[model samples]
Target: MTLQFSGWLPGGPTRPTTARRCELAGGEGAVVRYDERADSLDFAPDTGPHPHGLAVVTARDGHWCLTNLHAEDTYFVENMESGGEFVKVAPRRRDIPIPFELARLILPVPRGAGMVKVFGPEPHYLAPSALSGSAANWPRLDEDCMYFRVLVALCEPQLRGCPPGAVPTVAEVIERLGDGRPAYRISRAAVNHHIDYLAMHKLRVGEWAGAADGKRSYWKREAVVAMALRSGLVGEQHLRMLPSRRVTARQGPGPSRLPAPPPRSRR
Candidate 1:
């Protein structure tokens, strides 16, 4: 892939609220579906690659759920991108990481699919500590807050798929930071110090947005992606590239416009 580092300006919201991809027929093609009501997309396989294969369906909720063979793994959908007949397919992984303040995952849609939904609501979450005090009481403020926010953000909408909250939750953070360690005892003051250190050096929070209309407004993740591109924080080629038609143009090769080479001294 050609990795370009051009920055993108923050643009107003675009259509298709949620994008999704599903592995079809054993990873051949994916069916991408966006739902305005759910503010998300549903991906399924279009063909059966094997008599039995695994299909992954990812939603806007930031979770990937698996579909079994006996289940309805394949589906038919019309292409919004192309005014063609409906096709059967599954979603494919473009594996693009769209950077926000942090990296947000971006899934690719099939070539023919277009905006399926518009103007969907943003994802919501309840504070993690609202459920339990165990991890909530952890002393390290920054780590605790970041971990709490990420876990809560991932789990809140999928409560039915998850278990009841636990104080010291068995979340990914615990495993990543090493579970059952006394590091959580690090004091709030120390956590603040680390945050300040990061701010002074590496981590930056830019382009603040004010809340209006009784709605909590924050910078769109795309803004951060644009900033990263502009600053060369991440390569532009990493952004999901949609298929496009080639522009027709006529041009001819031209000789270099340069000063004539210096005459060689003859012996």
Candidate 2:
């Protein structure tokens, strides 16, 4: 939930002089305030859905603090005597997935110390240069860089789930294609294409006969099996054989057989 990065200070036997603190608020989006002189950053308890996720603050007493808004504990500055350096904190907003259009808008801004509030029914851009005699060494908008970083972080889980060793069966591929559809449609060419894609990816293929239409070739649960194994959703041994217990019941009964009659002849 929290990550810490530390390194030896660049200067010899001296602390890094260029330390700045910024407080970020997240609601509809993020608002950043620089040069905060407060000893501790103030934030409402994260009771609502839009809780703060990251904060960077430098105390007036010469201590730098970085807090993971996702975590509820105070992270302390330890081993300061050894010239330890804290991680550089960035003003970031979450929940709002950065869009390509928005990234385009921010890339042109000049770089320097400033505040950005990106919430409301519509976004508002404010710069110190526009206010008065503010020097323009502003922070470079670099929206593309930020956008890509955020996008990768958000999509990495889905990409990582699709490991080379994890392949989908024809049925699974069809199911995925039909995810938003009311029902799935299976066809010979579709199945073949799905199988070919899996084979190219070095995924194993399995097939079974359809119970309704015996001529149709049904796919085994290779996709689910692979994902379950790769993601630790199920144990590795489960991949070797079908599960002994079912998670759900089908509409029909099991293999039909004549029930044994009681010894009614005794009556």
Candidate 3:
């Protein structure tokens, strides 16, 4: 068997977001899935000779480690470009790092999505689809805050796990960020423009509204939020930045350090 990719790999660096293969740890690697049921990464064996060795890392922990099933280990051929949590997979051969041939054979699943599928000798774990990865897609900051805000609205509430909140409409976004009572508010029309921006800049934006039967159409919202969370755009900490939690911090009075000044001169 060989790798089968969705063919969503990027060629080189893309603006606002860089796309160097070697930039992030073995960033040149392909995206793979994490099988929660097997507790192992899913890898489909290929016809070509395997590479020198496999390098693995995990999001469960930020640590990187190596394990070799054979002494032929020389290079680390694993791909990490997808930025998902990495898991160690034993290499069939130990000569080169992950072989380039595997690139075509490996299908990219969403990084850290915890997808599960049971099939091969090893149960097939579900992975996020290639569309789940959008390292090359960058939103225009100044012009697309609305879009970014949309992602924040759709994604931030239940970043890692589902939290209490509704799928906010564009009106809520416009009012929340717009500071509706203030002069610098955003208009509903502008919010529409930004939603359009999500199609290209955000991962899984379009999928939310058109999901299959019974699944929450809002799954796309979760998908994009998870993507944003993984990619570092809007994190758990950023949730406080939301308008609902708009409390200003106050500094308490401190101890006196200097002597009290003489009564003010009647100058």
State which candidate has the highest TM-score.
3
- Tens-digit lDDT track for model 3 on 99-165? 2212222222233212221111112345756345546554434424447666666654355333224
Q: What's the CA error at residue 156 for candidate 1, in Å? A: 16
Give stretches of model 1 more than 4 Å off: 1-178, 206-267
Q: What is the per-residue lDDT of model 1 for residues 1-267, given as tens digits with 9 covering 90 to 100?
A: 011111111242344433343322212333333343654445444444524333323232322222223243343332222211233444442222211211111222232222222111123567987775555421222433443233222222122212212112224323323323466433434433433333223333232313222252222222222233234333323222211224558888889899999999999
Q: After superposition, how far is residue 26 of candidate 1 from its true place, in Å?
A: 17
> What would the TM-scores of all predictions be?
0.19, 0.19, 0.32
Question: Which window of 10 residues has the lowest lDDT sum in candidate 2?
Answer: 100-109
Clashing pairs in 2: 111-137, 111-138, 111-139, 111-140, 112-137, 112-138, 112-139
The C-alpha lDDT values of all candidates are 0.30, 0.29, 0.40
Worst 10 residues of 1 by lDDT: 1-10
Candidate 3, TM-score vs. the true structure?
A: 0.32
Ten-residue region with minimum lDDT total, candidate 3:
113-122
